[model samples]
Target: MKALFDTIKIYPKLIITFLIVLTPLFTLSLVMNKYGSASVKSEITNSMLSKVHFYNSTLENEFGRTIAIMREFARYDDLDLLSNRTEIMNYYEQRGAIRNLQKELSVIKNSSTYIQEASVHIPSIDRTISDDNFGTIQQDEFDALNVLTNHFESPFIYWQDRLFISLPYPIKSNRQPPDFVVDIEISIPLLKNALLQFTNHTAGNTMLVHFEDGWRIGGDEPEGFLQAINSVIQADNADNAELHSATVDGQKYLIAFEKSKTLGTTLIMYERESTVLGPLDRYTVWFWMISILTLIVIMIVSYSVYRLIHRPLRTLVRAFRKVEHGNLSVAFDYRGRDEFQYLYTQFNAMVQRLQQMIQEVYEQKFRVQHAELKQLQSQINPHFLYNSLFILYRLAKKSRDENQIRFSKYLSDYFQFITRNSSDTVTLAEEVQHAKNYVEIQKMRFASQIEVAFGELPASYVDLTVPRLIIQPLLENAYKYGLEEKETGAKLTVQFAEDQADLLIRVEDNGELADEELIANLRRKLDVQDAGLETTGILNVHRRLQLQFGAEYGLVIAQGESGGFSVTIRLPRTTSM
Candidate 1:
């Protein structure tokens, strides 16, 4: 079993892996395409049904309230007085009751959002009293209203392009027109507005249908389209609210409806079938296309992998083994025009680079040793040591015990730090403390000639590992070169600052001789490639920082804002070397 496993190559293994990863995805896509459509259809159906039921209930409640008001107003004793012309003709005597009755009609009309007008008709007197008018109605108008009451069993009647709810509903006998009829006209525009709410949300059409009477209130569709929807609804024969599918004028539609038993009407909402299921159908096509595309890609990738990766990898491996055995002359000779061609060219260049880098490494070692020797020689400056010992001797002869003790201590700490060459790097705190010791020694030597302000190192950067002796050189240079000529008011400032990217230790001095020409010379020296080998001053610090951290971070020198010179030593903000 182990031998057989070892015999299998990368090409077959990769093909097997591709099949393993993609088979389940293809199966999952097929499963989702099959079941997902049904789930989406069910959700759409429930949503449309809920909307249809909501609008249907809204219409029923509004019409039901108007009918209730009409029925209640029909029993008022004032309506009976308007039944005969004698009671109505007694103008002065009945005027008070007549005005009261008109007020009541107005109240009823104003009570419902759907009520356009409310009126009482007296057939015997041929008079009508409405919310707005009290006068005789046309005989044709009375006849039209009278005929509606006789024909429809429901109080909700559609007559002569108008919708109304008449009192004394569910007319069973169709006897003589009731002595007085209370008619509440429903505002078609208001009903359309109510229906528009549903249609606007669903991008559908709405209809309030009186199926038996063949009348509808809210659809601008062709008669055949409306008839087609009605046929589908009747064919469904569902008493409860339902969603149905129908074909009208060769265009498919999805219809949802609920019947209002109180108003004796069906509220139907229908939308284009494509509009409802377009997303699902489009997703199905994309899913199948992607599944097939992925399968083809697997096959094509397997072939490409064998032709591209497997062949180049083998050739590169052979070249690597020859180089691993110390044969530096091995080179790849690939001719194909592809990424492998580039890789082969790079491999050949890399072998040549290896030979050249060997010689450069040896030269670099020699240079580093030479620079270190120069660094050691500059650190033990005979002039600086002579001056320091002479100052101690002078302080002792002056019989200044306090000055001797303090100066000796500062000198001891300064020599101890510089002479101790145990490591190439030290903590920033230790380096700053060493720099302070040198500054203190100089202060005592200058004796009130210089005002030195040493800034406190921030706690965040105190523990950072930096190249040794980087900061102290800047302060030494400031004192020796820049401040030596100043007679009085020789101000020296040392500050520690940091930003988002680097930590800066700035040393500035108010010296008379420091000028732009000196700063430009220092900057030009810093830019020299071999500056690290020549001097043990700012350029040495710059090169050491560049070698340790990066070329971007080092020393920057410029004119100080205090009419003097400033030398800033920049180090990366890091916790370790």
Candidate 2:
């Protein structure tokens, strides 16, 4: 069975495939069939009990009217005098009294709908009369059925074509003697008429059968019903059996039964195996068809999905495999415009970039080694400058030349600033001091030709971090390319201020602004691997800032307000300062 089901997993578009999937559904049908039979039986029992209640009510109503007549008759002024009367005929011959009492009795008897008979049996006169004589019961049964009204139920009741229910009550006098006995009878057909009110025939025929033994109410099955009832008792199952069935020859009869615990009795109801399960059979057929269609649909869908998506991705895998095996010339065969296709195009571009970067590395290996040598060469740079300043100091002291001393001190401070080699990044305050020292050093060479003005230092922004030598290079570029060209007092201003959501540091000079073509070419060179130290510094600062604070905070270069172009360094409001 497991192997058969596994075959369904492989090829699901066949009848056996549905047969496996639909087995649970068939089991559910059998379960529902059982439930339906039990449900119908429960309803049948309720129907019969309900009918029995209606019959009891009808009898009460019929007998109630006869009682009313007797009550009215007892209220007469001469009614209590009946037991003490001397003679029977004399009591009737009591002038106009008998005639008047009989007339009142006649009106009371004829006024009721359910009352078939209303009569008084006078023990003193040994006589009995009724509105009508429907039938009579056997003497023994009548004697057992006649009891005082105080009892809840009587021991006997007669079953005939006419009245199926009867009750007797006494009418006593006040002389420690009895006045009469009142008898009432209710017709059976009248009660059965009320039983027909329940329109649900699937429940079964409802009837009230009050035998001499006891009463049996609820659902009437045709036959083989007793055996099912015997099963209920034999099992001693307190909870009702949901459904049971019996086969008489080739025909099957479904049965459902429930017993009322209070009445200490059983109720049996049966419906046909076909009638109760009609809807279930139809639904099962429909579900079988749907299961077949579902199996076919899953197989078709799985195939279609594998072709559209997995096949295209498989092509990409082959291209990567070829690249892995050192086939550098192999390219992706991309056909669609999706993420996978975009990756294909990007992979081709990346391969070209990788080849170019490899070639440049081979060419620049000498220059890279030379820069490392240069970096190591500058380690004891301050010591050499300090010895030179020391020699100049001794010479100036011996000769008493104050101007020489001042110049040597300035030189010492300048070399110390250059050779500190503290870190690659420093605060804005440190950068400003470095810039001032550079300006002082240049003054000795290009004396009074260049003017440098420092912007107001904001205490809040002075602690801002910048790459070391970034500002100094820009200042050098300004003097070399901009302010150096001016004849009189070339001016340079380094400004810092908060600009809306950004912090700006503007370096401007009274010099020349490069043309658009130069600016565009410089931008391209700054983007290249073989770019010089100047472009590399700006690109490194910009890329680091972009990596740290994102693309919005980086270098901005443009033509200045007055003369030479400016580089405005932009910073974000992420750090506290």
Candidate 3:
């Protein structure tokens, strides 16, 4: 078994695995396609039947309500009086009765959404008054309506291409016109609109058909199609709602119909079978195509396994071996438009990026070490120590024990921090404390000449990490160069402020001798690209900050608004170093 498995390589294994997986899937799809298509057809039929029945019920309710309203209006005493001209003997009496009848008709017309106009016809007065028109209707039009009233047995009648519901329905067996008729013209447009809502999203047609009168309405299809549908309904003679399939003009259709009991009309909704089953038919075709193509693909993949997979894999393994041996220049070249080509391209790019990153890392390490050495060399100044010790000595000699002890402690902390050389960065709190210590020592020496104001450090920024000894040098420069000229009221301010982008630590001295030329010279020195030229002082701080963060976050030196030299150390607003 082991030998057989070992002898069968990846090419045959892949083909065997794909066949095992796909054969059952193909069979399953065929079975599902048969059942799924049937399910879809059944669902469409039920949906269409449900929609048609709903719309039919809606129309029946509307027509029934309108008929009820007309019947009620027909029984009004004013209509009875107006029906008999002899009862209203005078012109004023007749006019008043007709006016009252018109008012009632207006109210009834406005009450029902389906009532386009409510009218009253009086045979004795030889006039028809409607809510829409106060004048009499045409005599010939009235004669036509009268004829329909006697002809149609249903309450709903079609006369002169208009639909109406007339009161005093179920005409007498004598075929004689009644004393007065209350005719409510149905709003065909509104009815059509209601019917259209059912088929708005579907490729279906809706029609309202009156079989007895051969009246068809509310459809946009051709008259021949509608006539064909009418013939089917007539031949079936099914009064109840039903869903059926029929063939019309060489095309099959799914027809859903419901009969309106009140109006004796049928609402028929029909759609082409293909329209409903198009997606399923397309899926069936696609399934067969995919099955055949999958077989072809199995053969194609077996052929390509050697050319696409085997060769590229060998090349990749060789390239990896070269890289393992420190040969980073190895690259894989594949020109075919396939996944193997993408893999080879990415491999080449990764190798190139690895080489580039190695060089960057080396250069960055060297720069950091060089900057740290300069910081160490510049911070360990003998002159500053001499001044601090000398100040301590004078204080001890004067028998000021408290001042001596305080100065000694500040001096100890300051020198310990500068000499430790443990880390390249410290918290803002530590740096600010160190700067404060230097300020205190300097204040002790130059108490009479200088007045220093050190702003409180914000608690939020206390933990921010920054380069070591970045702030102290600025204070040193302010005291040594800025406060040297002023004797009285020589204010030196150390403030911390922050904006959206950077944290600013400013050192300003009210030196009257400082001018634009000095500020310009200092700015020029900061902009110098030659890193080896200036390794200490403000230049060192600026370069170190730029290297740590980015070039945008370093230093800004300008003349103080009042009269002094101000140097601001701008560091990025970040939580970590």
Candidate 4:
């Protein structure tokens, strides 16, 4: 019971923080993924709607163009005058009328497509001795023509075996009576091609299939072939009768169906679906690509955000806890020189200074404090001597053999650096050696519990001057926070390398980051200098680096492989300060 209470007293906030942060992160990940998938689906749907609109627009354009051409031909001054004449009761007596009709037919036959014949209606024709009214010979043809004259002038373009338009014009009767109606049938193949043009595909074998009559308005031969056009409406009842399906040959066509506004008959347009949607089918492929691209973008953005914000914050929190637990010299490692590097430096220094103060006032922890009484106490910086002595003391107690002798030598070098703050610039060699001393003392204290690996430092690069104790404090941090949690032996790797103009020092350990909430709490405590409870070694390094080298080079923390952490510090080879 006492041991559990003490453990709780030690890491109460840490337990709470781990539960809080982990749960929220998992929730955030799920929400983002769900919405991200919805966004991709919406984008794909919008693209499909656009394609539908495109198809409709194309069909409308083809119809509009054909209507315009028909209107243009109808508006000719001569044709209009002949057709609009109310005074002409009969037309066979008028030579001028016949000539005008002949001329209009010539123009339509030559200018229009699939137009085999074109002629004007004549009411009176006594010279021929033969007459055919609306329902006499071909009632369906006459009715289809009546549609063009009455309704929308929406003439159906007929193609293939049983397709043709019924165009009705007023014909005149001679000495007998008044008005007469003549039905004009014309071929309509060119118009089919024009409509198909919008789809970017060809109209193949466009024709009306019928049993006896054959392909009516368009196609080769004179109604020789026949088939059933599924869409071509054919009927004969008491009130109406159309040229029903004619049987000349046998074959079936699933033709396109269109209604005539004027004649009340069905105009069948035959063409295959593949022929219409083939070229534009590539758009479907592009649509698929767009969907795939959106998914990739969402995945990438989610991953990047996780790395930039979530991962870093969590790492700092864990690091902060180590510093919280009196690990003032905690390692704060990161890759690339960013704002976090500065943060790492501040955190480590603050914690270390806080720990040193705790040591200086070790009596305060178990001793008394008065709320009203003020006591004058001398402040001492134990970092100068105690750092050396603390290492030796711990080593002497741990090894019990040569601890006193090894620590004595470390203490002498420590004083030499303490008294002589003269040479601000030390060779890379000197910095490397100084860092070695710090690590060796810790190695002795921990007693084979921390494994230290040093990268080879070139002799020629040793003459470079560096801020004293730079690498030592960083190494101290790795031991303080990262390696302290090791079960058996913690591995510490130090590398001293120079690029074109900068020296890089890296310290790594096989320890996971501390709890995030603890890091934040400790940082707050450091700023407040919350008695001897908070660590602030990172703050000390931050200030010292700024005081010695500009405001750039400093500590940074990173969660490396297997959740281990690393600390990196960059120092310019020729730092002016």
Q: Highest lDDT, which number?
A: 1
Q: Candidate 2, residues 1-577: lDDT per residue as tens digits? A: 7775665633343345445676787678767866875686567545544544444444444445555556667566544445346365364455344445456555655665544555444455554444432233344434443444422233224444444223343333543324554554544454444444432455344434333334443344443554444654456575443455665445565544444332233434444656655565676677668767866775676566545665567776787787677666767767878888898898888767767776797567546534433453254435434555565656666767755666666676656655666554567778777777666655654567877777876777778776555566677677767877788857788898888877888888768656667667656754554434443345655554554455677677767777566777787644541
Q: Provide TM-scores for the models.
A: 0.78, 0.34, 0.63, 0.29
- The candidate, 3 or 4, that scores higher on lDDT is 3
Cα lDDT tens digits, model 4, 31-93, are 665565556545533433343344334433443443444455445554444435635635553
Task: Tell me how far candidate 4 lies from the true structure as C-alpha RMSD in angstroms.
Answer: 23.3
Worst 10 residues of 2 by lDDT: 148-157
Ranking by TM-score: 1, 3, 2, 4
Deviation in Å, model 4, residue 315 alpha carbon: 53
Error of 3 at 537 (Å): 6.5
**Against the true structure, candidate 1 has what lDDT?**
0.80
Show where candidate 3 strays beyond 4 Å: 1-51, 84-88, 132-153, 169-177, 201-205, 231-255, 270-305, 308-379, 389-409, 416-428, 443-577
Clashing pairs in 3: none
What lDDT tens digits, residue by residue, belong to model 1 across residues 461-544?
A: 888898788878888888888787778888999998987778888899988666789889989888887733565777778877
lDDT score for residue 215 of model 4 = 28
In model 1, the runs with Cα more than 4 Å from the true position are 1-20, 33-37, 81-93, 147-153, 168-177, 201-203, 289-303, 311-378, 382-409, 421-425, 445-453, 487-491, 508-532, 546-553, 557-566, 575-577
- After best superposition, candidate 1 residue 1: deviation in angstroms? 16
Best by TM-score: 1
lDDT of 3 by residue, 1-577 (tens): 8688678987887788779988898888899998998998788778887888888887777666776777788778777777755553687877777788888889988887777888877776677888656666566656655644432225677877898776643256687766776788888888787777778446677888887888877777777888788777777766777887788779888888987766677889888878887888999999889888989999788778755666668888989999999899987667789888898999999999999998998798678756665555456667777887788878878966677888888888888888767677789899899999988888788877998889998777888888788888888877778786677888888888878867888888888767889889889988986746667778878877877787788889988876898888887767454
User: Model 3, 501: alpha-carbon shift in Å?
Assistant: 12
